[model samples]
Target: MIRKSRVVLLVLAAVAAGVLLTAGFNVSPIARALLGDKEKPALIPAAAGLRMVPVDIPQLFKEVSPAVVNISTTQLMKFNHPQMRNPFGRQDPFDEFFNNFFGRMPKEQKRRSLGSGFIVSPDGYILTNNHVVEKADEVTVTLLDKEEFKAKVVGTDPKIDIALIKIETKKKLAYVALGDSDKLEVGEWVVAIGNPFGLGHTVTAGIVGAKGRIIGSGPYDDFIQTDASINPGNSGGPLFNLKGDVVGINTAIIQGGQGIGFATPIQLAKSVLDQLKDKGKVTRGWLGVYIQALTPETAESLGISGRRGALVSDVTSGGPAEKAGIRSGDVIVRFNGKEIGDEHELPQAVASTKPGKTVEVRLLRGGKETTVAVTIAEMGGELGKPAGGHDLSKNLGLTVQEITPEIAQRFDIENTKGVIVSGVEDGSPAEDAGFNVGDIIRQIDRRPVSNIAEFTKSAAKFKAGKTTLFLVERGEARILLTVKNK
Candidate 1:
């Protein structure tokens, strides 16, 4: 009976296997399903993990290169050189005779240069670097299809090194959209298309190395640094992202350095593009104050906690800042509700504001925080010019000492008679008026200060709400500094 049972069981198992095969049921999967394991097989390779395939960038270039145009400029320049007539045409004894006989003559020369730019609109408005089109007698733009158009300068902001030019075209021209530079992250992939070294429409790829870099190019020196092989003639070209949106305008490169280049953020150009398009000029808001970065020493001296914010070195007389009660030695921590990270950020922030806009300025004064409302003034033609405002009382701003022989040697004052600045109260108006510890106060309101007594007498006559002019000698330069006693 046991042998018969074993044979029966083997036959049943064989029949069940045949049935499962005929029914197209995967036995292992069925077994797993029966065991309550229902997870599907993952596509990610277990051994190799995820893989990145190379992108087809040639298609990207074809789509975007049409907007990248070659810029050529011609300027009429005058040159002075000795013109010698080579009558013999070959080596001759009289070659020296003509060279010596000809005097210096002024001649007109045509200087032609090449650069790159991008179309920002279908109507043919283009953007480029100011240095590329500055003083250009004639500007010409060449498209990828070899079509050329004469361009005229719309406007230029030399402070940011950006320019706007326009060309006339009946047909709708291809253009690239400007991207948000603020959103671009460092290490993000980027591509640059430009006419580098006069080579037309070259494409190079790199990653954004950094942002908010100050290159000392201008007062507003925010630059985007990249490593996309930007070279000469690539200036004013477009630095695009994977989506073909222009995030930066290629502007400068480091000489003798590989993989180092700089671009102006597109957001900066876009901010002033409307003004450039409408009025052919950019007008910015001005808060008349001379500001410097607060170092740890300066911060400690001013009784501040951190080495952040911009230190007010001087304030302009009758300017918007003074009108707003912003004093020298006041550390500006915030402007328009935006925290000032450093000195460079303040200039850019202030310049971007519209004129006549009332903004709140938060500052740290005497270890306390205060807010002031200031109506910004029109920048006009004096964007970077410096003026003066000072505080007079010794405990308030500055102190004077008699110019003794030892003092002359210590302060390097050649003249031995005038009163010298002995101390400057931190954040004082006199300090804000650009008074240093060694500055010699030669005269006050045209009254010559020969000694400390004379300076004390003149300072005692300082009336509140009156502007006092101080004739100061600093490093061989005589300058008049104005102070308001308040």
Candidate 2:
């Protein structure tokens, strides 16, 4: 009976102790006594070593926003109807009647637009997008202190959509330093300061979503993608890094897309900034060679080892490439000591090179590697044109013509060896096979076709409903296409 009573007391004591521990009673001393706690080892948080230092964005904006400016432009647009004519000049009877009835359509209209810019110099040199003041007759810049100034268009490069404008001001102005955009990593914090929707000096923060993004804006399509809220007036605004340096220019946004924006890397702008400031235009170097991506299939067909370089489709006659002895089917692996990774990289590198400067071009020809010295030329004027011809294959929808001296001079073609494609019937087999007007037919089924007679003879042997290989020169590039004979 005594033993049973002692067991009941011990059970009741355990229940009471548990209730006391659950009801906010101190139990650490009791645990320490049982667990032999050595100064109670400090508890470590899960994210103790992985915490990121928060960026002081407010302080960053305070230092950079003064340089940001609001840009407004006015353009005069003229409207002319097909039948509308000057009342003082001779007019058709029907045109005169239409004008008299319509009371002379509104002669002109004024277009106004708003954009953003940033001062890059204390002397008031501002950088903005070329499209902002492209055809603007009057440009006004408003500063952070509500001061306004008439800005002059210093220079513009429409290809890359960059403009340098100057505001004549003696007052001290804050300027943002240009940062190395190439060093900017993806996921780094960035801030965009602009006048979105004409709302003055709006700031948005986001991380660099990606770099080297191609959105088909132009030939130089390298853009930095961000999730920052960029709107219409944000065009030409400065995208600043954490160090208060301008790293990118907020340029474009996707319509109906949330949090998708694009900025032009400041590195590209810096490349032409001096030229834009001095020459009032950007002069890009030209290589005068048509190039295509070296795909695996193309490499295998060319007997090349790997697709690591740009494949030369065609070399322009009398141009830099032809003068340098670069031929069609050559793969350019290196240019001016810089390794060419792909076809896209070659154009950018060549364009960035100074015109009239000689550069070394390393290429592979027929499984042999060789280097050639070529002088770069200024990019301008139309490269080539099509020749007049007669229909050679109605079923194939191809028109061929022999290259005559008259035709060569008329079309500005230096080499007159291959037959030119004059036309391709729409929706025909040849058109579907990618045959275009102005294509020079060089070979059919591995047989050379130098003229109309050769082309007709080669094309006549094509079997109906059989696919035939064709090699053609188009726009300084040679390409192989397959056409299923109809």
lDDT of 1 by residue, 1-486 (tens): 999999999999998887666345544433443444334211122245443221435667898899999999999998665434556565564656655675333378799899999999999999999999999999999999999999999999998999999999999999999999999999877889999889898999878999999888888988899988899999999998877789999999887989999999999999999999999889998998877777664565467788778877656667899889996668899999899988888988899899999999999987899999999999977444333312346533787777778877876766676677778888877877678887877767656778777777787888876667666766544555667666
User: Where does model 2 exceed 4 Å of error?
Assistant: 1-55, 80-105, 382-433, 437-440, 443-448, 456-486
Please tell me which predicted candidate would have the highest TM-score against the true structure.
Answer: 2
Query: What lDDT is obtained when candidate 1 is compared to the true structure?
Result: 0.81
TM-score of decoy 1: 0.70
**Number of backbone collisions per candidate:** 3, 2
TM-score, cand. 2: 0.76
Residue 376 in model 2: lDDT:
97
Model 2: which residue pairs collide? 313-478, 314-477
Best by lDDT: 2
Over 46-139, each residue of candidate 2 has an lDDT whose tens digit, in order, gives 2565423323567778888999999999999998777644676666687868778886568898999999999999999999999999999999
